[model samples]
Target: MSAAAPYAALSPDVVLAAVDAAGSWSDGRLLALNSYENRVFQVGLEDGGVVVAKFYRPGRWSDAAIAEEHAFAIELAAAELPMVAPLVIDGQTLLRHEGYRYALYPRRGGRAPSLESRDQLEWLGRLLARIHAVGSRERFVARTTLDRATMIQAPMRAALGSDLLPAHLFDAYRHAAGRVDDAVAQRFEAVGPVRQLRLHGDCHPGNVLWTDAGPHFVDLDDARTGPAVQDLWMLAGDEPMMDALLEGYGQFRDFDPGELALIPALRAMRQVHYAGWIAERWHDPAFPAAFPFAAEARWWEQHIADLHEIADDLF
Candidate 1:
């Protein structure tokens, strides 16, 4: 696992000062919190209450991205949608400290639910529908939806046309890229209107929290306006995964043939990206259970094979 450098330095004084400057907390004690890509700390105040401070990784994201997410969360909440709203500090939703932008949030209660319950799956679908409903009102970001070619081509392109991926992946990427148009077009026509809504770009099971109220969504860092199918695509699985979710989601929203058509390819894209990321981070002990090494490697292998088989049919 290649983790980035830790934030400049984390301490109670630094955290308290940041929160105090925000006017939300007068005086608070800070406790270090755990995070994968960002720095999190639990700030305890004189009144014995706590707030979570999330500081973004310096090189990982830009200030604009952070602010957009914070604003989007408030928008969602105002629209009666599920989101982790961020606290304003120093006249900015994101606080700049130690060369990193941060946000403070009152900790909410929730846990990941076991997949055994149908109701839970239904809740996931309904909550996702509500997220889509509110996000579509405005253009949150440009080019929210990513076509298959862009996924396979962009990184390679950035690598200066010098395929840095392993040999095995080269073939898979090439195969997918060659016929990207047909697959994307098929999906667009089937799914209808591209279903572009401001979306939680990474709304997998792990991002969802089964709170006392219902399924309360957290982790809006990857939130963006994009194809709504992208959310369902990330939840791809055998019958248990799709059956209830599709049924439940349908109750809140309907998908045209175009959106439905893109489901499979989009699902494949999600799995491909996830598998690649997990494979890269396989050595990290903290990589979530969902991306366990053995299972992920197996999935990646199968995905490569699937890519090979689907190559000709994509177009």
Candidate 2:
């Protein structure tokens, strides 16, 4: 595999062989799942059951870090929450084959839960509070932390390096991004140090899968250390949703109303993060093919405008 196409050597034949190497016999039917950072697939088993196989992005995470993530999920599942942890085989959840790291999970099917439903929101809040209760028990020694530096500064550096960023917008982008970061920094300073815990870092509604039982999570690929609010803000897009979630969340753990102040800052950070992440990963074939907007200077101009708007709102 070349640096440009890291997964060029990871062909379908190798995927099937990886499964077999891990002691699971496949029926030779491999259906790719919707994932960009990592290659995930649904492989049919000899027993007619299917398992989800996730191949980690090379060089993105260390083996120890991945193992730590796996352990966190397994811990959450053990709490009887609706979290889907990796299936352990021969005392190993992380497996290696042909220089690629992978893991297996029981195939779970569920639809996206309705964030509009108060009842569903309340249920999710209760469970999320419980998740926080567990997450606060320990800390991640190897995972990422949600902060302006990693979320904003590092990404800005990556974007600066990408040639896709229009030369005309170079200074504009820098000025706009620096303003946003400064605003975010001031807000963080005002908020002081928040009590951060292990979080389902990307707890947006789409990541939530709902069944007749309730909410269950399948991917912890984005799990990291962050303020509890980071997990809540995405799922609770508005005040009413926040109320319903906090209503249930307060049932198990106390809600810090002060954390509410950080919402706008977080929103702006995420906006910058999306643009910067695209710029950083544009070299990946999937990114260029999937996000064609970044190639346009007009898009960058609009992004800078949005950043300016966000900065104005923050101050």
lDDT of 2 by residue, 32-92 (tens): 9998889999999899989899999888888888988899999999999888899998999
Q: What 10-residue stretch in candidate 2 is worst by lDDT?
A: 1-10
- Where in model 1 is the C-alpha error above 4 Å? 1-17, 20-34, 142-144, 156-193, 240-243, 275-315
Local distance difference test values of all predictions, in order = 0.63, 0.90
TM-score of 2: 0.98
Best model per lDDT: 2
The prediction achieving the highest TM-score against the true structure is: 2
- lDDT by residue (64-173, candidate 1, tens digit) is 66667877889888888767798765567877655556788988767876566778777777777777777777776533346554454443243223323455555655
Candidate 1: worst-modelled 10 consecutive residues by lDDT = 155-164
Cα-based RMSD of candidate 1:
5.0
Error of 2 at 298 (Å): 0.5
